[model samples]
Target: MTSYLIKSILCSGILIVVYHLFLEREKMLWFNRFYLLSALVFSLVVPLISFEIKPENVLKPVITAVPQIMEEMQKTGVINSMIATAESNSPPDTMQLLLFVFDGICLLLLIRFLVNVSSVLRLKSRCRNVKIASAKLILVPENIVTYTFLNNIFIPEKTFENAQVRDEILAHELAHARQMHSLDVIFIELIHVFLWVNPFLFWYKKAIRLNHEFLADEAVLKEYTNVKSYQLLLLDTVLQGRQMALTSSFNYSITKKRLAMMTKIKNLNRQYIKQGAIAVLAFVLTLTFSEKIYAQIEFKSKEVAATFPEISIVRFEAVADKPAKKPDQKGKSGPGISKAEIDEFYKTIERNTTYVKNKKGRTDPMVRMEPKMEDRMYELFSQMDTDQLQMAADSGIMVFQMPIPVKKAPTPEMFENWKKPEIFGIWINEKHVPNSELNKYKYSDIAEYSLSKLYGGALKGRIYKYQLDILTNEEFDRTYDRRANDRVIITRVGWVGENRPKSFAGRRI
Candidate 1:
């Protein structure tokens, strides 16, 4: 909302400057009227236009290593202390307050607008109707200047009674009525009520009213012979009486400019040049005030793997023509962890594990550390290549050990319990299967299975917290174990063993 308002103000300000500089002094009255009205409408709409910019450069997909957590512990005593500092103590919203103040002022302005309309209607009802020059004239008894409101022309009783006053005053008000200038006045005033804070609105109101006066003065000059005498009449009505907000009054502070414009000679060539300039400005502003969007392309298959070798884990062939950036190139390279930093991380882990076991007496194997494990861990880091090392640095791994739980040979009852509806989801042989299909696989047929927690607790409107995956012995040896032929290697901060050994699965000592 704030961005839209700022853009609108900027666009209107620039267009108004162009009007004052090039078009204001010209005798192209109708063109000036069109420019002012269209400028306001265009300012509010141009910011919504958008253009999408598609770049030729392609971006490589980055892969991250993840470690699964088996269990977690927290202190329940801090719950009350945390709840006491919730959002209730936060500060009030500034935008809501501003909207409230804006609405209040707009409401007041609307009431004042209604009161002005009511005053005009009341004067219309009390005046004695006098038909003059094929239009009904309302001879107002109050001491107010001659003004036009919608189709009604209000003339002061004295001005109507005076024999000396000519029909130029009547002619001016009738032009306003014929051209329906009251609609423009109402439109701008209502806009002013809502956007009262914008400084450009004041300038807009002044320009629009001045343009209306110019049009009316031209209309009067077409019917009358002498332009000087009409200028004198405008001068005499300078301080005639008060004017209503919703009406086009005869008297304006810019009387001198009106008189000068009447005698100013029209240049047809200059008018055409100004119109062409306005067309160019509109085109430029449409481009300037619009939004720009960038397009992204996605790559799939083995082609991606050969092109983006630095991506670490490539699943597709190399088919892209553009070569990937070299690791030594001076662009955005991945973070590198120093030897000292790795040693600090090891010390922090050792300290925390020792504290948990000694102080809390926790016997969970996941939290326990094996003896002389740091030597094997440091050796794993030393063998990694540039991409592997950079990926490890970016993962921000906190713990150094990850353990996979092993279960005994499964029974029919155990297999039945796994199929319960209480579980979040189940996958058999890496394919999601229904519950009825689970009856076909016996307990002895199962080779390996794992239960893992889902970080996104709920997905696609289902309450999912944990996922269970099972692999039949046939599927395990034939596909699962040999799946590494594609060489999708992942780097993690932990002990390693091949095929997940009984104690530490991938631990290479």
Candidate 2:
């Protein structure tokens, strides 16, 4: 983007100087004082309409800036709703979206080959060549060197025959090229083309032009043995200056002040660094006013946490139901949970219900820092699977540790209890499967292997087994463990149900 700014500024000077050289002065009597206006119009109307603009190319930071704006918007409204804004194009409205599109299109036009080619065509004819000049080429006009990019050189029939005059002329153009007045002219033209809206840009162009002439004049005096010789040559060129359609000349009559600057003896380096610094500073300041885009997303996840720099919770929603109840119809032996057991469940629930509700109604403290991220986390958890919600809700989490099934002569009671549905999912970790030869234990092993690792308890032999003696249906008094007098506290609950393990005659570890 900075590069484009520099490039455009450079081209502006070239175009302006070229136009002044080629076009004749306007004769509109009423607009006599509007010579500057005419020049301005030429700079504005000519290239702008002469070329074309399209969104397909050109430098567009505005498009890039959109995403950044969106990100900022989201951050600002974390706990609330998105704040919407808009823009339009009519009447030169700047914030309008369409105008932004126009801005982007304009910025992008610099890249087109057609525009550069057009610029080249406008200044088609080369200025006179110089054998004595040390530069690639020179365009010293017969009039005061106009610094304007156009035809400053007034070519007449007998111009080159005067040896002393020609040498002085060579001295002057060499001054222009050495000091790079031509390049400076191009730079000003570019600034005018793109930044024509800026009034200060016009002043800057003039200042830079004046400086160029100053530098060139100094060079001419250094090259000539006597300052008088150069001054006489400049005078001769200025008097007989015949205008050309498209060249910068030695003595452009309009820029007489610039020639006078060249004639003066001056110290160049005393302020060179200071002036260069000012130009650089101005160039840098322009960057603060730029256009580019970026976006933001709030994501919350324990799994996703490892990958991201900031783990923002986007949405969280909790499912409102419990896991499907112990499947019915299967011949299952459920522990006859008594009134004592139900009371214990309520006690567990009461222990952890201390929740803080914020203005946005988030239930977790981790979410409050970034409202949007928290809201997202809340939404996700609120809508989670029933099994997860039930697990979160349940205080008495059961941890099952399945034991290896050692094959022994199968007892009638063991076989009978193993075939029940109440004990479906239960297992130890994968490593407990034992040798492959124990494959027979894979079938019907749930009750035999599963035991409460949290509280020494087990379910086997068609009954809910614990350390307490198993009683018949009549003897079972209702309680959490079916022991009316004693209650066991349940902590973490998990069922590592491995269907792959052999179920035949299994036992708890």
Candidate 3:
């Protein structure tokens, strides 16, 4: 995941950098603009459409079978697998992660909005300190509204008094303001934020900014009378520092480019139709392959997803909550777990703390077991409905949701020494864990392991540490803000494959 994240960032960064280079050149050559815009649109649309094609409900059917299948396998000590999907993350979890990514995006957007608003407020404050020259500046009512959030233009009152050059400057900057190029610039900045890792994205920002200046220059030049004077005025103008997010200004950094753009010789004989066609083609070409970085990245992650990233043996522990449902609502346990499926979930707490009876000659009995409160709850959790899971979650009974770290994935070569082994006979020394020393077969000790094997996954060699606490509504709500780290340890981590013989028949069965 970390590698993929870094790669995605680098991909976006490259795009931004390339864009910056294009902007520095100060001319799009018609076709360039076509490609950039088209590519941006395509990149945005593909992921959304891909989601619908993949569908959100992809995991529902498999999850529906987990409990019953686990039960049967646990009961009969048989391996039950019809269609085993290799481990990636689940679709719901993936969707949640994507939402989390978007949440981060929204937070960034909000930060920008606040920063802009704060800057505007500061600007408003500066209005009182603003110095006005009564003698040197005379325009339409002393304030000509010369610039906006984008062009970042300002006249030193000395230059504004020149009536001849004034309107041209006003018109040029106005062109930028009318187009809301400042907002465009802000949007570009945000693109850089998301795609900053992509160097081309950095370039894209510069290119787009320059394009705005060019577009604005074209607008004013078409209407101004003395083109040479206007060009001279632009060339003499000092470009100011970039302003806050929402300011339009004149004298933006790309002034020389803007001046050069004005020098382009336009002739009546020049074929507009031919230029238009070439521009269109150029745009189409660019659009088809504009997003070299991000698109390439998206392709890589997809290809990698197909292979075994990790062997995720997912298991869910049932946490208790909710009142009893009608008997009809609880489906008959499919094979192995149906008998233990009776709803003594809470009362079984006493039975849970009791130790397992591994008497002489019992068939694969989990002799030593001390169940934690949470693990016991998880035993019951596998039996609950999705609605019940939600209720439990809402009612302070958290289902300790866990997925193994993606970092743990090992290569096929690494597994060369590993053997192909089927997990069987999950035993817990309930006498050793969180509860207390135990005597006879307390149902919870053996029953919980049975439940885990039946529903979650076969846990023969592994041990987890689980502990649960009964929290009030207030406690739950108070800590709800940060639940990511919270978990009830199941079985304490333990070694596996130490005692069991080559086969159950050879051991003691």
TM-scores of all models?
A: 0.56, 0.32, 0.37
> Which digits, one per residue and each the tens of the lDDT, describe model 1 over residues 105-152?
999988888898898899889888777654568887766777888878
The digit string of per-residue lDDT tens for model 2 on 220-295 reads: 6666667666666666556453333223454454356554544444344633543454345434433322211111
Runs in model 2 with CA error above 4 Å?
Answer: 1-155, 162-166, 177-180, 183-201, 228-246, 250-287, 292-509
Weakest 10 consecutive residues of candidate 3 by summed lDDT: 294-303
Instruction: Kindly report which residue stretches of model 1 are placed more than 4 angstroms away from their true locations once superposed.
Output: 55-92, 131-135, 161-165, 296-509
Ordered from best to worst lDDT, the candidate numbers read: 1, 3, 2
The Cα local distance difference test for each model comes to 0.60, 0.33, 0.39
- How would you order the candidates by TM-score, starting with the best? 1, 3, 2
TM-score-best of 1 and 2: 1
Q: Who is ahead in lDDT, 2 or 3?
A: 3
Q: What is the lDDT of residue 373 in candidate 1?
A: 46
Off by over 4 Å in 3: 1-38, 51-113, 124-147, 150-165, 193-198, 239-242, 245-253, 265-509
